[model samples]
Target: MDMLSCDLDRTNEIPLYEQLYLYIKREIIEGRLHYQTKLPSKRKLADFLEISQNTVEAAYEQLTSEGYLEVLPRKGYFVMASEDLEYVGKLDVPIKTDNVKNESFRYHFHPSIIDTAGFPFQQWRKYAKNVMDERNSDLLLLGEPQGEFELRTEIADYLYHARGVKCSPEQIVLGAGIEILLQQLVLLWDAKTKYGVEDPGYHLIPRIMKTYGRDLYPLQVDNSGVKVSEIARAGIDVVYVTPSRHFPYGTILSVNRRNKLLNWAAEADGRYIIEDDYDSEYRYSGKSIPSLQSMDQKGKVIYMGSFSKSLMPSIRISYMVLPHQLMERFRSELSFNNSSVSRMDQHILAQFMRHGDFGKHLNRMRKIYRRKLEKITEMLKHYADKIQVIGENSGLHIVLVVQNGLDETLLVKKAETANIRVYPLSQYTFEKKYEGPPQIILGFAGIPEEDLDDAITSLMKSWGI
Candidate 1:
């Protein structure tokens, strides 16, 4: 085997060795260099290229480190197997593409988005800068595999006081988002975990479970919350519920059903309940419901929460409280998994929680959103004869069932004519399809307060109400 064409740019800002490395790497990726092709010996290549042997050696070492080249005992460096290459070369063919831009809506009632206007950006920036100080220099490195101890401790303290969740720092595990934590929980399962989720659930829960190869059974959500009878009859080993405020529908799990669900978990082996206490901070009416984990004496409930809804979504911080049983499994099997969240972000959030900024932020958002909801409620009253409002007591969004004559399709189309966007509630259903009523979800948090009246007026005119 002979050496392929090799060149390096000396004038470029990139180092000579790095230039040589990129040149050789591209040759292999472009199929110019075949498998088992021997590279030029460092001494020989140095002499041919009029460069020092050390320079050639450095380039060869990098290629070997990256698995592009391998050395035989007595032979020189040879290109690795073609299949071992990390990237495959593609043809550079030009094709015609569409230049059309996506259409924008005037008013969008997206349920997932929160009110960003009230976000404590300046306060967060201060904490972020504070974490970068010399005293916290160790935070720059990989500090904790689970999460930063300070953040976990702060989360535990906040949950206990705010949501009545019982846990310590040792039981808390932080990750980038709830999706990541759900995947981790699935991986922690030891037995055949047949997971049961609400029919019109958060939607992501079932998808994540499916990705992890778990059998998902959709349980219908009745007047209270998830049907406990359906869960018991399904013979499910795991149950995921948003008891504090069910997503989209905003139904709180009644205490009667909570006990039955707990009893079901106690009777069965390898049974666990995942209580997603998401967005429990902003209840406008009545007392905030205690977390299902707070009621569990047998450690059956795994409490999950995130700052995405309460704070900003880009924070990428979510946490889970593992029961003693799952906590042991997480330690023994998945403890080595590095925390997905950054240590700096964790420290900043910890400081925010400790300084009571988080609590203050939630209080302010509650009042802001409550007032917004009040205006929205008053606006929707004009169409009360044509629509029935649901899930307005809590959460950022409300579900409106069209009562005049329009179905989900017609309602959305009519709303679109007014430059307003609305989401169908049926989209949240798994296999059940939620045929009770043709409902649409309208989020008031992200919309401007001043535009609320105009958006509603446009909808009324468009719908001929």
Candidate 2:
């Protein structure tokens, strides 16, 4: 084993004994000193480091008291077993050898953090076994690109009963997830076509569309959702809107705007609409609104739905509901590209849905998530004067609008020092000249309800609010 090394600056303020204690403790926890491995004798370590024997003895004594090492009569000390440590490694070293030569990169929002601790692992295990136990030839073979017919059928039924979306099994085309569906849509649509995306919307759409050399117009949004009048005037061939709950802002598109937007798409001479109904399943208010796809009399909207936000992220399954007019073209394009979701996951999800367990699981999660949402709201309310908490009624995240002149960058840095994570809303915008109140997007769904109060208190102290 390589001997662990540390630099002890005599000029530094921290005591050498404490520094040595930390270093030795880290090594033992990292398994560098394996079970029953003898450490260097105190005199040898002190001589090598040019430090006194008493300091080395103090470090060893502290480590032994902390259960990182065991001392035997006259045999000196040995490292403990790996099972005794809570975490199995030392802190990761910085990537670069020289800190001054670091390069800067654009900031990106953190990925959605889900609390896996609360996942229904036992129930999922049962369902997984049941699926394999009842497996047949189709389950083992390459299934349909539109996904197993059984899953499509189950999804159609679930959407109808739960979200009031009118659809048949044939209309639903399953893919790996939202990104995959977006890729397929870009492939089906010609590269030269102009696509309209909401300003300050999900940042991924612009990046994805740009990769295919498609022209994009950043349509503006307000309290009612994406502005239909502006989108109509933009003269774009394709419009992508999240009507259920606007991303980041979390505003539902009003019924009037939804109808007007659909009418405009119909008048635009066969223009297409991509509706991303991503987290609409967890609304905590009045009845869930019917999707724009349900109101498409002229076959203008292509509905994309995903189970990533509803179920677990590992279940990379999402489906698109296509209009009958574009169904053949979509199928032809998808077949040429060979894009499809996993056959096994599709079968398992189908079985879960058919047995009515999927619905039951959703109901149970809704209750749990509702409680979490309330806790977050209560905490935000406690800081009402200093922070404006928006998007409280729906979705997994809430936006806190901070007062002007506050440096969000510094606040975020301070929070990181306390081990609390948050994201700035401006990171999602594409336009550089756009300005607004400083805001942070905090996700409560992934955090424990019991920790909500402490997390909020820590954030407040960090901000000095």
Candidate 3:
């Protein structure tokens, strides 16, 4: 009801605005400030606390940037409820604050979602401010067609060390998203470059392929990852795969399959593999698999990765590391094409990576996601007799095939009726529909750590488990 007033220590190293920002943030997070509560105006707070309006504005801006508060234009600042914990359950528990705001679902088990609750927005905001400063005016102009060289260099180095992807900065092409990069590839290559995709692959692949009118073949995926036999049988020229962690199923491509695929790529003149190591850093266990591009002796692998999955989706930073031939061809053919991503954002990201903030944030997120996975698996053991966890031993999402003879649609419906959303694995397929037992895909990343038990409990009860 009242404005935030904090005692500022002028002698302290931290700025006055930051002190006020922390105090207000604590009030909101600790539930001292009620949801939707409006704070005093910048001028009013400045006078009340005997601080400059600029200082008050800076504090509010920081809070707004970090998503702890919301600015409603002329309406002044209002609280965007950070009060959290998603649970449509039998048990009664007080809600805890999470990063999500303006929420809809009680529980959304979206496979593509990430842990936004723990994102390093503070660091990102700082970088963003520095990038936009007048000193970096060059970033305001059009950037290189492929992306900022500085950003690409950072990406190239990160990829080499983390995923064993061997590529120079010149080969890396940055785009707003994987879709845009895929569309670029479609436009660059000949129309007859038929593409083969893993069945139940990342949903974005088939859509991009068909949209561009490329001949699309649905390659089946089994325990060893995508079936190379199907690729050869289909006489496909290019293969798109997620070798590190397969989609929905989460199976890693076997070493034998990897070699066979490489051989297929090498055998033909135009054959190539597109490896989408989107969430490679989130691997929970086992030896790190070498990327397809790293293993390629020939210039036949086009490696693509995204910050959308590993980091916040809003970043919209995705990259492609092309073979030498394609890189040269791209430079010659698409020279006029400008960078899809904002140069300001690119430079900020480059700085973030160079300062090791990106790596540190990624490491912390991996640990958080890993813990969420463990908790979900452990909770599922309670329903072990009723559900079969069919997912691979790693990644953000898990697959559960119910013992009950219901179809995939019914499984999803049951969960939705109980205020929980569970995706059917069949929905992920492009051509070949899943005809197995009742199955659903649930991502642990979207669920808050404190809400897992109740969320799982409610979901199982909905299924009559």
After aligning candidate 2 to the native by TM-score, how far in Å is the CA of 3 from where it should be? 10
Query: Tens-digit lDDT track for model 2 on 110-144?
Result: 33655567667777777777767644655776767
**C-alpha lDDT of all candidate models, in order:** 0.83, 0.76, 0.82
Candidate 2 colliding pairs:
none
Q: Which ranges in model 1 have alpha carbons more than 4 Å from their true place?
A: 1-103
TM-score: which candidate is best? Answer: 3
Residue 83 alpha-carbon offset, candidate 3, angstroms: 43
Candidate that scores best on lDDT: 1
lDDT, candidate 3, 191-276, per-residue tens? 98889988887777776777888899988999889989899888888889998788878788988999998998899798889999
